[model samples]
Target chain A: MNVPAATRAIVVARIRKLWPVLLVSVAAALFFGWLYQNAIAGRQAGGEVNLGAPDAWLLLPTLFTTAIAVAVAFACTSHANRDPFALVEDAAPLFGRERARANAIIPVTIALAAAAAQYAGARLSPHYATPPTFFLFNAIAAIAAMLVALSIPLRDGAARILYALLACGSTLICTVVALAVIGFTNGVAAAKAGLAYYPNFNDLWGGVAEASFAALIGFIALRQYGEALARYDPLPPANE
Target chain B: MAILEMRRASFARGRTNIVAPISLQLEEGGTLHWRCELAQAGRVLARMAAGIVKCTAGSVFIGDYDPKIQPVQVKRLVGFIPHPPPSNPFDSPQAYFAYRSDLWNLQCASAVERGMRIFLALHAQPPNLALAVSGALLHEPKLLVAENLEAELFDELANLRGAAALFATR
Candidate 1:
């Protein structure tokens, strides 16, 4: 088979294997979104609703998208890394690198699809059209997770687990720092004024955080891919 | 001219030398049995020939292509079947062969025809064994590197000595 044909076959097989997980993640997001909307509607009907902030409308979907994206990214990466055919396939000409690159595309596509669905669902209600910034940040966060997942080496159970934990923790910490800088800039009063003047500033820090995380992931993945190509063995020496 | 050649080639795994420096050459239509007491040595040799493992010292060449520099070309010229034959419980031999053929870029019709011929010739053998041997031949590789072939298959291949090169290790 030619390069394109081989790549297409590999990607199709991966998607087929991951269909169940993707389906469940999207379905769960939609279900929870529906419930959240209903809860808000009930409170508003009883005149007991205290919507804290207008941007809060975007929080539910953002969190849902991030959670789902991270979960799917982790599952896809872990499965690909541990596949029985990994070493054999990697040894094949043009197959290994193509497979690795193709694997990343699946999680990114799924994350984007999930984000779109959430945005569209939120649009159905008044005053709930999420800002474009939210969608952008969510997509970036998901892509960042996928890149981090793909950057990890395979065949080392303990190392894989540790790297995964560290990656997640670092991403979370970076995001919080970005949010704090944006939320506390020039004191809370000036931050509130800035948000009022430019509403996108409300979640601007989220986008910044995700963008930086994606850049870091991209760097790590490049290095890892280079090392993989140069190395003879997939696993490190048993001694170390 | 040798179709597969190794010059003082040695391989090390985590500072432990698996293959001591050895030089060998096999012509286009020759057979070589790499007799070694260690199964790991045989496995490493097959992988080196197939470009799956790199030689730490000296060099390896398949025809004019160096496996280290032109791995794709070298791999195309060699077919390797590791000992015990890699198998998946979920995959039938037919499905496995089909996938292998695609990966190797073999013409589907020709691969199928060759597979059938091998199957008929080895009809008395176990189905999986027959299939595994036939699957490796689907691409009509110039050199076949197998590990621990049974007597029956060895005899069958011996009859075709003039048609292709064969290498086996135990």
Candidate 2:
């Protein structure tokens, strides 16, 4: 088949194999969003909520819940990618890079979709003001989670333990970056100067910067994955 | 000219050889029934010959393409049917055939029709094996490699003139 046709086929097959798990991921993300809403429910105090800035402590639950949901969701994708019939595909007249790219479409789509779902779910909470750029941060975390998930080696003795460590490590880094970005965008300098309490933090430029950074990381990760697929041996020689 | 050739091709994991260095050739319309000392060894050797796994030493070629350097080209000319028959994930034969057609870039409807025809002809055979063989033949590959398949299947493959086959057995 032509490249486009073959790519379509691969994508269709992956979707067929992964729809159930993808659905589960979306549900899990939404569930986490619900938990975030409940975590900060006490801060509302039945008063008009300020749209300027949420306290760093209040954002903790959002970050942790979203990050954990994204990580677990993507880990399931890693398992699905290791199909037993992969040997059949390996012998096909398709480039490994092409196959990898095709295979990635579904996972990436699920990541974005699930992230959006979480954002939607979190938006329902009356505890905090939801910024328009909040979805962008969630998107970054979701992609990061996917990258960490795919980096895990399959069939290793301590794979589950390693997955947990990597998930936590990546989430921690993202959480720090997210907090810093929030501080910078919310006018940390302006707040310190005692000028405006919380200057309208609608930061288009900051959002663009965050998105560009995430896209760069995702591109590099996908390229590395494709190269690895090209040299992968589905059936290594037996030790005996 | 040989359609498939292995010059001392072997597979090794670290210091141990799984499929010992072996050489063989199969020309157009030829057949090679290679019997190995162990089932695992036969399985690995067949995969090497089919270009699904690279040989640790020496080389294997399909037509004029070296599997090590031109895996896609080699695979384009080869079809592999594994032993124990792969499980059928499709709900029906049509689904399976359509999937094969899409994967191989064949005429979708016609490929499905042809696959159904072949699948029906082997009605007495196990469903998984029949389905696998039908899928393997969908693209009309130049070479067919069977891993520990039954003899009756070979009778059917032999009837497909102009194609070469390699049957690996324990």
Candidate 3:
């Protein structure tokens, strides 16, 4: 069958939606690399890091918490909004199933779970600040949620794009907000006491606060996911 | 009365049409089949499984579930087939079933080991590979509708008679 030019266009659009996620995940990974270097090498990775860095690295898992949250939000949005395997899905193989509902809550739930795990884990293991384990866990959780949401069906071009935007943007927004709060609080000099750990666990408030938000975010996200699912339509004879 | 019913249902996306004025009905012993020579059959099947597309342009009834009013309920009765259920190469059959079973809400008493062994024995497929074909026929639902087919598949519909069920599939 001559593939419709329109189908090709949709494929391109899906790629575009996925691109930002790729870019951001890379950037976050690189930044975390620096954090690792600082913690291990006992020297700044490159230039100087501000002292009163106003960080929630103590309250949260810091780099990883932020990265995972952003990564997951983007992943779920993209998966729901795009026909990642459009050609195959359209073929209607025997006993094949397409999901009509997108579970936004799952990712958010995972995101919260990730944040909680990171916060609590980091707090418990304050000796090494880089906390690679926390970051790894968050990344895994976000990806898992995305894969699940992608199982659902989506019919609208606009809705797909919007889903991606929501997924990619929401956690980043949370991360930014967290950063802003940290900046406002300004890292207490004592916050740096865990140089062996990079960000110390002396301040346990971050883990608790971020974990709570993770729960709230997951709750709100599930509701939104369900709403999006409600909007799906498989065959569009009417619109045509 | 038909075990499954579809009224003048229509669906649209933006300005394009996806499903058009579709009306149909099925009794207990009916089998219907359709195949779209389009991109990604799995994606197409997924879209059909999701319910917001049906409109009063007519209504659809499945068992006691109404497509218009109880979409989630209809979803359970409706089994969608994706040719290839996604999977990780390293995952065991037990892990794969455990993961997807969470999504599909299959009977928990039905152990992953049992499901894997049954499909493996029936399909003669490898244990680790995730099969894309979603076996909705097994749900023994009061009503069911799905895409795609193999000539021999419905041949065994008789085995499902004990389900005392009603459903149709394409």
Candidate 4:
């Protein structure tokens, strides 16, 4: 569909309007990457678990999630463009436009700062935290912004996908907490230590977090394409 | 049966009266020419824009029912074109004709052939005057209301001595 120039302009305006959300999303990916490269990937795990393995495939999900964050940012920009958030000159600002600009940006910067803080915080306090838990909180927060971006007004597809990932995210975080308690109290016996030594699904948690973030961002970017598909994204029929 | 009745309707923009209270009666297969001066075209075109003449205000019976209430409903059976100039920025006359064909609900495929022929015959380059517009006219309209057309289409009017024989109805 050839989005009229007028519509495209509105999208840019919306992006500027919602710049903070996008900033935080992109910032989260960078922090996630930092955690993967510096925190989890650095530590020595069991030979089988392989957190320190060279060229580990663990970074895949982190990259994926980063792409998704970009997509959501682009979509938010595109949607605003698609419908100019304009009201009658005398009327109040449009729905999403009403958010405080300064406050919004502050949170975005703070969110990124928090993610970096979390990643470094975990790397320093490795005994108290597991690799999965370190990445999991960042994942949860990145997922939160995706949920918020997609849940605005009538569009909920973003929200739905974010919700599903978030559910899976909760399960992963819970497992990490359980492992930490087990490792702390009973002590690291050979078998238990081997389990920790050998890398497991917890590593995948960090990877998946990145993958999810990037996928969301990539989708939004594609949606911004001018003269794209002929139809508005009609959600698939209920049965489909 | 009379298709429309304007009744003494007057439309205004602010204090200016664009079109005064004008009344006219139309029936299927009826063709009438205003034969008024050049400025009258603007007034008549305003009526087309107002949805009063083309659809409502008057008893406008195109095919089955009165179109006064169903403004868009009249579009399938009717097509309108205002004089072109500043409004059309398209590269070629055909470019706009093709776009407007779908936009105005006219046949698109044949528009290319018809547009080429019409522009070639009536409108040449040097002077480039938008002499006349023909849409759904190739098939023949039951009634055609054209304003400010050149002398060439005078006989094309359905009531003209040489033309009424062509449509056999309008």
Candidate 5:
């Protein structure tokens, strides 16, 4: 069979198996959105509602997108790494660099889609214009999460642990940098400056930090993946 | 010409040496039954022969192609049926064989014919195991490396000994 045909078969099979999980994730996102709207509605009924900061609009959506992206990545990596059929699949003539690329498509697609939806949702919210930089940052972060998740199945023990730490550490550093730049540099006065103006300095800095971290993690994962492909021995040695 | 050759090949997992330096060669239409009590060792050997695992030291070649350096070419020349049958509950035997045929770029008609022949030859064995054997044979590989061959399948595999180099580990 042709590469395209085989890839289609594999992808179709995977989607058939994964559709339920994907549906559940979508439902979860919708549920979270509903809860957020409900909370806002309740607050508004009581009287004065402060919608100055875009933080509230950004927080839940970002969390949901990241959570979903991470989940998809983990699922895909774990399936590829731990499947009993891994040896059989790896031994096939078609199993090579192309297969790895093909395997990444689903997770990457889902992640980017979720990020886009989150961005659109945030933009439509009453409190924020949702800066382009912020949107780009969130998209990168989601992609990074997917990459990290993809790497999990490729390595084990210390290597896996190290990658996990790198992902978490980088994201944490980005958050801190974003907070320091936005919270410390601009202070409360800038935050209260409203959403009509250019994004708060902190949001832009946060975007920069997140994008840099994402790029770092993405670069490392891709390099590792390439090396793994070069080494490309799926089965373990006798003792191991 | 030798279909499979290993030159003082050694394999390590982490700090432990699994396959100590060993040299062996199997020519076309030759058979090697590497019997060992250590099932893991058998598995490692099968994987090495199939180009699924690189030898930590020395070299391994399948039909003159280095498994480590030219894995795709080497894999095309070898068929590996690993122990425990790499089960995928979601796939039926037919579907699995079809997928394998596609991966190996085999002609669908010939693959199906060969698969059926193998299945019939192992009629008494479990259906899944029979299917697995047929799947391995779909490519009509020049070398067959099977791990943990059962007593029943021995005769069937031995029949291929005259045509394709056979390597079995148990």
Candidate 6:
């Protein structure tokens, strides 16, 4: 049905209104990445290069949390603003499932791009080497968490607040679980040693599990969003 | 068979009924002007017939397709001009037509050019009723639903061969 073409059209329309927010999302991610690099560099110059001393271990979690928060914020802003689809909605030969998928494009891209940018920036630190295998999977998990948070019905003020909290909490939980998996597989000794070498198979398996978890959550959340989009009635709000 | 039909369809919010149960039909080359108050209730009714608002009871159909179950097919068959038409986002009429062509994923450049010429010819006043109708007709839909349209324009619109029209009047 030329789903890509339909999705592209919708995204283009949305981008006209939302380019500023998207720019901010990317800038914020880059800034955080630069900040992480500085933090690690500062710790290394002072001779406290260990992960625990500089709280270097907190880097991944913090990065993911901030990226997801930005994504959630973007979602809220888009929702509160004028409906982008209102114009062509009734005339276009696109239904609810396609609409839902089209809607997710901007936010999901924001989350993934932000995560990638920040991780790249942090890699510039002299103390750090290649990124861990699990980090990518955890980043995916963050995307899933963001989707779950966005799936919360934005009918009212209470729902908005709940969505924000859920976004933060879900991403944070996913990041922590991913870290815990790595910690358990390699123990505290590996963490105490600076992150220099590539991650082992144990770490890789843990990452797969974490990424799989994210995929499952994202799938379910997307389906729910599609169903809700189908049932959604915009008349009441417009009439009021 | 009717190109558009509503069988005792109704819409409500909470306990209040926005549109009372109503039945109507329009066939090819025919026209129906529904008279109601313009602001709230009539707008809702027009949207219901266009499949933008689902009926709380009964059903609505466009060329044998139920809007609730086959929204894409119904939308493909129907051309809609809403009460408060959306403003033109593009700088030129050609750009607007291009945007529509891209959106609907149709290679109807010729049709778009024809629609644009019609739009420019008729768009002399404000609120852009001409632009709305011309844009709606770009898809060459079998049924057209226009809300709160000017009565004088109906004769002009009827010139389009074989397309049924439903106009909501104040």
Number of the top candidate by DockQ? 5
- Residues A1-240 of candidate 2 have per-residue lDDT tens digits of 555767887777777777886788778777666666656454545443332444455445335544544454445433323342454566678886787677667766777777776677777655445554655666665665565455444334476456546544554455445455545666575234221222333456545655665566567656766766666655532332
**Stretches of candidate 1 above 4 Å error?**
A1-3, A16-84, A107-136, A151-216, A219-223, A226-230, A234-240, B88-95, B148-152, B157-162
Instruction: Give the TM-score comparing model 5 with the true structure, all chains together.
Output: 0.77
Q: Evaluate residue A62 in candidate 4 and report its C-alpha lDDT on the 0 to 100 scale.
A: 33
lDDT of 2 by residue, B76-153 (tens): 788888776767766788987887787777899999999899888878878988888877887888888877655666
Q: Rate the local accuracy (lDDT) of all candidates.
A: 0.61, 0.66, 0.42, 0.38, 0.66, 0.65
Number of the candidate with higher TM-score, 2 or 3: 2
Model 3, A126-162: lDDT tens digits are: 3345445435334433443343334233424566455
- List, for all models, the DockQ compared with the true complex: 0.27, 0.47, 0.08, 0.02, 0.52, 0.44
True contacts kept of 2: 0.55
Q: What would the per-residue lDDT of candidate 5 be over residues B33-128, giving only the tens digit for each residue?
A: 877667776778888988888899999889999987788899888888767665554555666666677667777667767777777877876776
Where does the lowest 10-residue lDDT sum fall in candidate 6 chain B?
A: B161-170
Clashing pairs in 2: A1-B105
Fnat of candidate 6 is 0.53
Candidates 1 and 6 compared: the better one by TM-score is 6
Q: Give the residue spans of candidate 4 off by over 4 A.
A: A1-240, B1-5, B14-16, B35-46, B49-68, B84-88, B105-107, B124-132, B135-141, B147-170
Candidate 6 structure quality by residue, lDDT tens digits, B1-170: 78878899988888988778889888766788787753567777777777666889989888899888887788787777766666775566676666666667777578678777768666554535666777777777777877666676656666652455654543
Q: Candidate 1 on B23-114: residue-level lDDT in tens? A: 89989978887776567777677677667678989898888798777777777777666556544422455555555666676676677677
- Candidate 1's C-alpha lDDT? 0.61
Which consecutive 10 residues in model 5 chain A have the weakest lDDT in total?
A: A193-202
Cα displacement (Å) at residue A193, model 5: 12
Model 2 local distance difference test score: 0.66
Best of the candidates, TM-score: 2
TM-score of every candidate's chain A: 0.63, 0.70, 0.41, 0.32, 0.60, 0.74
